[model samples]
Target: MGSEKPSLLKGTVDAVKACPREIFNFWLFFCTAVWSFSGVAKGFDEGNIASIVVMKSFKTRFVLDHETDDQYANTKGWIVAMATAGAVFGCLACVNLVQRLGRKNTLLVFTLVYIAGIFGQTFSSGSLSGLYASRFIAGLGIGTTTVIPSIYLTEIAPRSIRGLITLQYACCQQLGVVFGFFFNYGITKHNAGTQLQWQLPTALQLIPAVIWGVGLLFTPESPRYLLSKNKRTEALKVLCDLRNLPEDHPYIQEEFAGIEWQLNAEIEAVSGASVWDLTKETFTVTENRRRFVLMFLCHMFGQWSGANAITQYSPTIFGYLGIAGEESRFLATGLYGIVKFVSVLIFSIFIIDFIGRRRSLITGICLQIVTLTYVGAYLGVTNKMSTADIEASSSATAASKASIVAIFLHAVAWSIGWFSIPYLVSAEVFPIRIRSLNVSILMAFHWAFYFGCSRAMPSLLAATHRFGAFAFFASICTCSLIYVFFALPETAGRSLESMDRLFERPWYTVRQVAYPTAADLADGGLGDVERKITDEDLNKVTEVRIESQTSKNH
Candidate 1:
C-alpha cells in the first residue's frame, strides 16, 4: 500500500465536507426565527393594535373613553418606547453578564422574557402599564436575543458560511416584523374591535420562544464557552455534538486548537492578567484594537443607515405618506418581508463570496440613500400640497404608493448590506479571547441605536414630517457608503487570523486594489488557508510573552 501523506489542509477540508450541514444550518435558522417572532409585532404592537381594535372595544363594551378613545393617543408611543428602552438597558447590563453567563444561558434567559412578555400582553388588564412593562421586559430579552445569537452563531459557524448564517438572523427579524404587520392586518380587518383579536396575536409571539428554549435545552452550549471554562473534554464533546463528529475527529482537534491558540495569544497581550484579562488584551494589542475599531464602525454605519426606523415603523411611515388602505399597506409590508427573506437566503447561498462584504455594504448603503431620497422627495412634495391641491387631485395617493415602493426597496437594500453584515463582521474579526465581550459592546451600540432610532423616528416623522426624517437617514447612508468605500477591508475569503492581520497593519490591501487582484496578498496568495501550529510551540510563546507583559505592566 502506498504511504498516506500527512496533509493538514486536505484533512481540514475533508472534515468540513464531512460535517453535518443540516444540524449546523438548522440551529442558525431556528435561533434566528425565534427572535424574529417579535418582528411581527413591531408595527402593530406600538399602539396600532390598541388604536385600531382594543381601545374601541373598551369604549363600546365597558363605556370607557379613557380606555378606548384617547388611550392609544396618549400612551401607545410610550408603550412602544418602553420595549426599546428595556432592550437598551438589557444589552448594556448583560455585556459583562454575557461573558459570565455564557451564550446559551443568556439566550435562554431572553427566551423566557419573550414568554413573560407575551403572556402579559395577552391577559393583563386595566392599566396599559402592565402591557408596557411586559414589553419592556421583553425588550431587554429582545436586545440580548439580538446580540447573543449573532455572537453564538458566528462563533460556532465555519468561516465560509458564517456570513450567510448571520444574515439569517436579520432575515428572521424582518420576517417577524413583516409577519406581525400583516397578521394583525388580517386579524383586525373585519372584526376591528375585538380584544380577543389582539390577544391571539400577542400570544403567538411566545411560540418561538417556547420552541427555542425547549430545543436548545437539549442542544449544546457554545463549545467556545466550554473551552473558556477550561472544560476541554466537555468542549470537545459539545463540538462533536454540534458538528456531528466522532471524539477523535481531526477537525475537532484543529478547531479546538485554533480557539485555544487564539486565547493563549490574547493572554500574552495582557499584564497583571486578572478577570479583566480580555479587556486588557483588547486595549493593549494593536491588532485587537484595530479589530475593535472595524467592528465598532460596522455597528455605527449599520445603525446610521436607518434600518431600525424602517422596520420599527413601516406602517406609520406608510400612513404618513397617505397610503389609503391599511390592508394593502400591510400586504405590501408582508411582501417586503418575503423579499428580504429570499434575498438574504440567496445571498447566503450564492452571492456572499462573489459580491464580497465591502462591495455588498457599499451597494446596499448607496441604494438605501437613493430609496430614502426618493421617498423624502415624494413626501416633501406631498407635504407642500395645499388643501385645494389635495382636494382637487389624487397626488397624495400616488405619493403613498411611491413611498411603499421606496420602503420595500430600502428593506431589500438593507438585506443586501447593513442588516446582517455588521454582526457577521463583528463576530468574525475578533480573536476567541474577547469575542463575546467585543461582540457584546458592538451589539450594545447597535441595540441602543435601534432603541433610539425606533423611539425617535415616530416623533421625528410626526414633527419634521416625512421629508426631514427620510432625508436625514439618506444623509447617514451616504456617509456610511463613503466609509465602506474607504476604510473597510474585503474579508470575503480570508481566514480569521488573516482578517485580524488585515486590520492590524497600518494599511488595507483590499481597499488599495479596487477588485480582487494578484497584488492583494503575500506572493498572490488567497489568504484563506489555516496554518498548523503545535501545542508545545503555542504554549512556549504563551508562557514567555504573558509573564513578560504582566511583570512589565504591573
Candidate 2:
C-alpha cells in the first residue's frame, strides 16, 4: 500500500454491494454528529468576538472610548486575536494529549478548559488583561477542539461518506456561528444597554462545550486508537458496532486488514526508533515532509484568502459599503452569518463529495476571485465621490448594495472550497504514525495565521483602503486557485491508508494518483480486486499475514 495504488474501489464495491446489512448505520451517524459538536465550540467563539466588541455595553465596560484611533485599533486587535493565540498553544499541546488520552477523552478534557475560559470571560468585567488571558485559556480548548474532531471523524467514518462526515464538523461550526450572530442580534434587540448583552453571548459559548463534553462520554474511542493500544479485540468489536455488521463480515474484514497492514508497517518503522529518529524521519522522509509542506500551505492559503477578515469585520465592511447606522450594520452582519451557515450546509450536503476536493476548491476560489475583485473595483470608483454626492446618488447606493451581494456570494464561494476542505485534507492525508504530530503542527499554524490575519485587519484596513484589502485578498485567492488546481489531490472517497500510498508518488505526479483503473488495481495493487469476499479468501489472507509476521519476527 505504501508504494502501490491499492484498490480503493474494492472495499466500496465488495463491502456494500455484497454485504447482508447496510454499512451506513444510525449509531455511526449519531456518534459523528456528537463529535462534530466540538466544531460549534470553536465557531461560537470565532463568531461572537467581533460582534461583542461592537456592542455598547462591551465598549463601555471595557472603557474603549478614551483611546486614539491607532490605540483603539491595537486594543481591539489584541482582544479579538488573543483566543486564537491561546488556540495556537492548545493546538501544539494536543499531539501528546491526543496520543495519551485518546481522542474522546482529549476532547472532553479540552471542553472543560473551554468552558472555564467562558466563565472567566463573562465575569471579567472591565479587566482587559483578565479577558485576554481567559480567552487565551479558552483558545487552548479551541485549538484542540478544532483538530481532534476531524482526526476522530476520519478514523471512525466509512470511506464512501468520510468526506461528508468530516464536513459535518464544518457544518456544525457554521451552525455555532449562526448562533453567535443571532444571539448578539437578539440581545441587542431585547437587552441593549445591559452588561448581559455582552455577557450573555460570552457565557452562551459554554452550551456547546458542555454538550460536547457530556456526549463524549457515550461515544466510542476511535477504533484505530484502540488498535494502536493493542486493544485488538475491543477495537474489532467497536468496528463491528460502528459498521453495524458481523465481526466476520467481508466489509469488516477488509477494512480491518487495510488498517492492520498500515499499523504493522508503522510498528516496524518505529520499533527501535528513538524520539530523535522519528523527528528526523518526519522531516527527512520524502512522503512525510511533502505531506507537511502541503498541509502548511493549505491552511495558510485558507486563512489568507480573506474569509476571516470578512466575518470578523463584517459590520464595519458593511458601513464602508455605506450601510448606515449601528443597528443596520449589525442587522446586515447577522444576515451575513445566515448566508454563511446556509451556504456551508448546502455545500456539505450536496456538493463537497460529488465535486470532490480539488474541483470544489477550484470552483470556490474562482467565485471568490470574481466577488472580491468586483467589490474592490466598485469601491475604487465610489470612494472618489464626495460624501453628500455619494449619499445622494442612487447609482452609488446601487453599487453599494451590489457590493453587499458580492460579499454574500464570496461567503458562499469560500464555504464551498477553502473553509472546510483544509481540515479534511489534514485529517485524511497523513498516516497514524505522524497524523497527530502533523495535524497539530498545521493547525497551530492555522490558528497563528488566524490570529495574525484577524488581528491585523484594523491596521490593514486603516493603512490601505478597504478596496485595497479586498484587492489583496482577491490576488491571494487567484494564487490559491492556481495552487489548488495543480497541486492538491482529490481525497474524497479513498481510505486513509490509501492516502499514504497516494502521496508516495513523486510530488509532481501526486494529483494523478486519486483513482486507479481496474486493470491497474488487479495487476499492481490489490490483486483480484473486484471479487466478492468469501470464508476461504479470508482464511488465505490471514495465513499470508501470519506467515509474514513469523518470518519478520524470526
Candidate 3:
C-alpha cells in the first residue's frame, strides 16, 4: 500500500508538470490583447481623424464665438501638434524609466498619465494655451503607450506566436482608430456641442486606460525583467505562469534555463552588475550590438515606409481624393481604418509565418508603390490638364471614388506588411535585458516620424498637389522596400535561443531570416536542411561537452 501510494503521487506530479505549452501561450495572447487595447485608444483618437475633427469643431465653437478677432483660429494646428511634441518627451523619458521601473509598472504609469490627460480634456476651453497643454499631456500618454506595449508583449509572449502577438498590438491600434472615428461621428451626429462632440471622445479613452491600469497592477512583471533584477524564483514563477506549465516541466525548465544561461553568459562578459548596464549593452558583446543595430534599422525602415503618414492623416488623404464635406471625409476615414484592422487581424492569424516577415514587408511596399503611383498619375494628369478636359475625361465623383479606393488599398497593404512588422521585429529580436530601451528608441523614431509626417501634412498638402505628396510617399516606400530586402531577417518559427545562435555565427545577414513558405515547414523543407536545430534539444551540446570532458579526465 505504501509503494502504491508513492507511485500514485509521482504520477500526479508528472501530470501537473505536463500542462500544454499552448495554454500558456494562449493566456499570454489574451492578456496582451487586453493590454494592447489601451495603447490603441490614443492612436484611434489622436493620431487618426479625431484630433483633426476636434480642431475643425473649434472653428464653430470658439473662433466664431470670439468674432474671429482672436487667433484661436490660427492656433488649432498648434493645439493638434502639441500631442506629438509631448509624445517626443514621453518617449525619451520612457527609455530609462521602462527598464528602471519594470514593464508592468511602467505601463501602469502610462495608463494613469493617459487618464489624467483625459480628465484635463474635459475642462479645455479651446484657448491656445489650454489646448496645447492638454494635447501635450495626452501626447506623453500616447508616446508611452506606443512603446511600452511592444516591450511588455514581447517579453511575455512565446517565440512560436511572437509575431502574431506583436502584430496583434498593431491590429488593436488600428481597431482603436476605427472605434474613435465611429465614436466621434456618433457623438457629433447626436449633438455637435464641444462637450458632447469633442470632450466625450477624449474622455471615453480613460475607461480603457483605467481598466489597463488595474489589470496591470495585478499582472506579473516580465520574467526577463525578473531575471535581470536577480529575482530568479520570481522569474521562474512568471515563466511558469506565462507558459501555463508546472515549474518542473522539461520544456519550461529548458526555456527558463536558456534565459538564465544567456543572461549569465552575457553578464560574465561584463565587469559590473546593474540593470542600467544591461539596458545599454554595457558589456559590448557582439550579440548585444547586433540586436541593437537590428532594432535600430527595423524602426528606421518602419518609419521610412510611410506608415505614419497614412495612419495620422487618413481623413486628410481621403479629402485629397476629392471628397468634400466633413462627414464624407470621416466616412472614408472610417472605411480605411476598418480595412487596416481587418488586414492586420487576418495576416497575423493566417499568414504572418507563412508569408514570412521580409516577403510580407516587400510585398506591402511593392503594393504601396503601385497604388501610390496610380493615384499620383491620376492626380498629376488632372492637375496638369484643363478643368474642362478633366470634366470631359471623367466625372468628379468617379475620380474621387477611384482615389479613395487606391488609398484604401494602400492601407490594406500596410496593415499586412509595414504597419505590423517593426513592432514584431523589435519585440522578437532583442535580448530580454535591453528590450524596453531598444523598443523605446525604435518607437521614438516611429512616433517622431508620426509627428513629423502628421504635422507636415496639412501644410505640405497646401503647398504640393495630391499627386506630388503621394509621389514623395511612393519614393519612400521604394527605398524602404530595397532596404528591407537587404536587411530584415525572417525570424519565423525560430526560438529565442536559436535566434541567439544565429547571432553567434557572425556570418549571416538579415536576408537569411526571411520567411520560407509552407514548403519550408514541410518535412523536406529547405529551412530544415539549412537550419535544423530542434527546439526541444538546443542545449544538448553543453551536456555532450561535459560528458566528453569527464571521459577524457577519467
Please, what are the lDDT tens digits per residue for candidate 2 over residues 26-122? 8998899899988987667767886887676888899987777677777888888888899999988877888899998888888888889999999
Candidates' C-alpha lDDT: 0.63, 0.79, 0.66
Clashing pairs in 1: 39-176, 39-177, 40-176, 40-177, 40-180, 55-68
Better of 2 and 3 by lDDT: 2
Cα lDDT of model 1 by residue, 131-246, tens digit? 66787887777766656776677667665445455555655665666556666667667656677556666676766567667876755677787887878898888666656667
Q: Which stretch of 10 consecutive residues in model 3 shows the poorest summed lDDT?
A: 1-10
Candidate 2: C-alpha lDDT = 0.79
Alpha-carbon TM-score of each model against the true structure: 0.77, 0.83, 0.75
TM match of model 1 to true structure: 0.77
Q: Write the per-residue lDDT of candidate 3 for residues 8-45, one digit (tens) a residue.
A: 23433454456564545566765786777766765565
Clash pairs, candidate 3, are 44-177, 489-513, 490-513, 490-514
Highest-scoring model, TM-score: 2
